[model samples]
Target: MRIHTLDLRFQGIPGLIASYLVESGGEFALIETGPGSTLAALRSAIRAVDVDESAIKKVFVTHIHLDHAGAAGWWAQQGATVYCHPNAARHLIDSSKLIDSARLIYAEKMDSLWGDMLPAPAERLIVLQDNEGVPLGEVEINAWDTPGHARHHHAFVLGDVCFTGDVAGMRLEHSSYLSVTASPPQFDPVAYVQSVDRLMAAKFKTLYLTHFGAVSDVAAHLANYRQRITEVYERVAAGFREGISTEENRRRYAAAEHQAAMQAGVSEELWLKGESANVTSMCADGVRLYCEKQP
Candidate 1:
């Protein structure tokens, strides 16, 4: 089986939302459809890799997040069997609620930013429980429950590569650069740590992150990710102990992240434009999750 990386140009940034196409024999499987608005990028990337759009007979989504599974329903409408976590099955079939919730969080740019998400008919959506193995053409993807990033998250292991969604966190380009974005409401720091450990124990040779491309040294990366996330949350937890207000706390937290990124050797220009915002948002989410778990 051959795996091709389809980079979705999220916010015009490369490697931000990578979808993969796994090929075997005469069939192909698309993993993570990216955001609905970014389907064109997905299509173009697939085509560039010599994989026909219609050859994608199945889709395995790690979760139902807009950036990850937003286009699952759309592709399912095109005759691809959509495979997802059982808890996310209903949402894929009737994405109205999920779309609206994302809109509330993302606001006015929801449609323009993420594109339209067409619901997959219930019959076309395949819901798999943890440890379920589903056939994708000639390959069998072992879908294991990989929650913590989200309750419904699943990581698919095919051959030597594991398509680890956000459960593996962000690994931006070279430089051992990493950041964990554990968003609020559903973000559980403890669960996230456990999930990291679970992935580490899996001993996969390489991990394909939704944020970018492949990461080898899976164990080391997971360790660094866990450490970074812990530090971010610990900083926030310490603030909570001092009774710091949310607004002040967020400012302080963002500032510290900015300095850390700079100290880590990230360029000043990149930090000002994109990297900084990503780290700040990640830190904010990590902070929120840590506080929620405290006491």
Candidate 2:
């Protein structure tokens, strides 16, 4: 089995998002279809590798987040079976509700940021329950119900490697700084931490992050990510406890993130790319909302 990491070059920025193409027994299975805005890039990447679109018979998404599975329907239209968590299946079949909710968050930039989300045929959309496995030629892709990044999130395991969507957080290649991508409406720090623990217990030899690329040091990477999640959640939680306004909290969070990135020796260019990919404001809002619901 071979896994190819296809960089989507989101917003023309490399390392911001990726899609993994797994090959086994001459058949291809794709994991993650970066937002529709980068559909052209994905096609180009596939062609560059000399694989036809029809060769990709199965498409597995970690979640239905625009950045992760926005272009899934496009692949389904090409005759691929789209696999996702049960909670995310209906949304992919009829993306109106999904688009509406995303518009509320992205507002005017929605079109340029994510592009149009084409809905897959209901028959083409296959919902995978927790612990279900899908056969792809000689290999089996196992799905684990790994939530916290979003309730609809799943981490797929292929042998010893795990494809962790957003549940594992965002880590730019070569950067030691790992940022939490706790987006709004479903970000639960408690569940997020638990999901991280679950991944840790599984002890995968490598992790394929949808945000960027592969991580070989699974244990350390996950340990660091788990710590970063708590740090971020506490930072936002503290701000709410102190009665700080959401905007102020966002500013402080962004500033702290900048400082941390600099301290970690992340280049200004890479830091900016990471910031654009996972906005600190959204992270702050997610944590703040989680805190608000607490007694």
Candidate 3:
């Protein structure tokens, strides 16, 4: 199987958003579709690999976040099957609720930020359950229910490589380090940690992160993700306990995250872009979820 990295540039961030294409047998599979506006990039990626756009047989979205599964309906229209965790199936089949919620968040910039996020026809949507196996010729991907970032998340294992949507967080191209950004309302620190532990137990050495490209030394990456995410969550949770406001937490965490990325040698521009591109907002959401779940 051949895995191609498709960087969906400037979808929201100048260089942060991305997706992946995996081709096996005579057909192709897309692990994530970036966003609705990323249709051109997706086609470009397939063409770069010499695969016809119509040959894309399946699209396995780890979750329904706009940046991950936004272009699925488009792919389905192109004759591809859309597969996702059960909870996310409804959103894919009827995106009205999801679009409405996103509208409230993005307000005037919805189309520019995400493009037209239409629903995939129900007939084309395939709901994947945990432990389900999807065979793409000689290679097979077993979807594991990996939640935390979102309840409707899945981590796919294909041979030695694991396609971890946000389960693995963001690891940029040039950086030798990894960072964690747990977004809110859907971010569950405890669940995220548990999910990481589950991934670690899978014993795969190479992890395919959605942010940019591949990361080997899975132990090191997961360690850093867990350690940093834990620290950031602790800081945010403490702030919440002390009656600190959500906006204040967002501001402070954003600064700390940016500095850490800089120290890791990310370019000043990419660092700033990654820090601000809904990452901190998601972190704030994660912190809020943690606080709400606290007894």
The residue ranges of model 3 lying beyond 4 angstroms of the native Cα positions read 12-15
lDDT of 2 at 59: 96
Winning model by lDDT:
2
Candidate 2 yields a Cα-based lDDT of: 0.91
> What is the per-residue lDDT of model 1 for residues 123-235, given as tens digits with 9 covering 90 to 100?
78888888889776677898988777788989998867799988888765644757667665577777888888988888889999888788888888999888877777778
Question: By summed lDDT, which 10 consecutive residues of candidate 1 come out lowest?
Answer: 273-282
Query: Candidate 2's residue-wise lDDT over 69-136, tens digit each?
Result: 99999999988999999999889989998899989988999999999799999889889898899988
Once model 3 is optimally superposed onto the true structure by TM-score, how far is the C-alpha of residue 172 displaced, in angstroms? 2.4
Error of 2 at 286 (Å): 0.8
- Candidate 2: deviation at residue 231, Å? 0.8
What is the TM-score of each predicted model, taking all chains together? 0.93, 0.98, 0.94
> For each candidate, what is the lDDT?
0.80, 0.91, 0.80
Ranking under lDDT, best-scoring first?
A: 2, 1, 3
**lDDT, residue 206, candidate 2:** 90
lDDT of 3 by residue, 1-295 (tens): 7888777775544447667778777767889888877778767767877878787788899999888888888888777888889999888888998889888877998888788777788888888889898899789888989988889999888988899998888876647556675765677778889999988877897888887578887888888888876887888888888887878877887787777777888887766666644567657767777787789
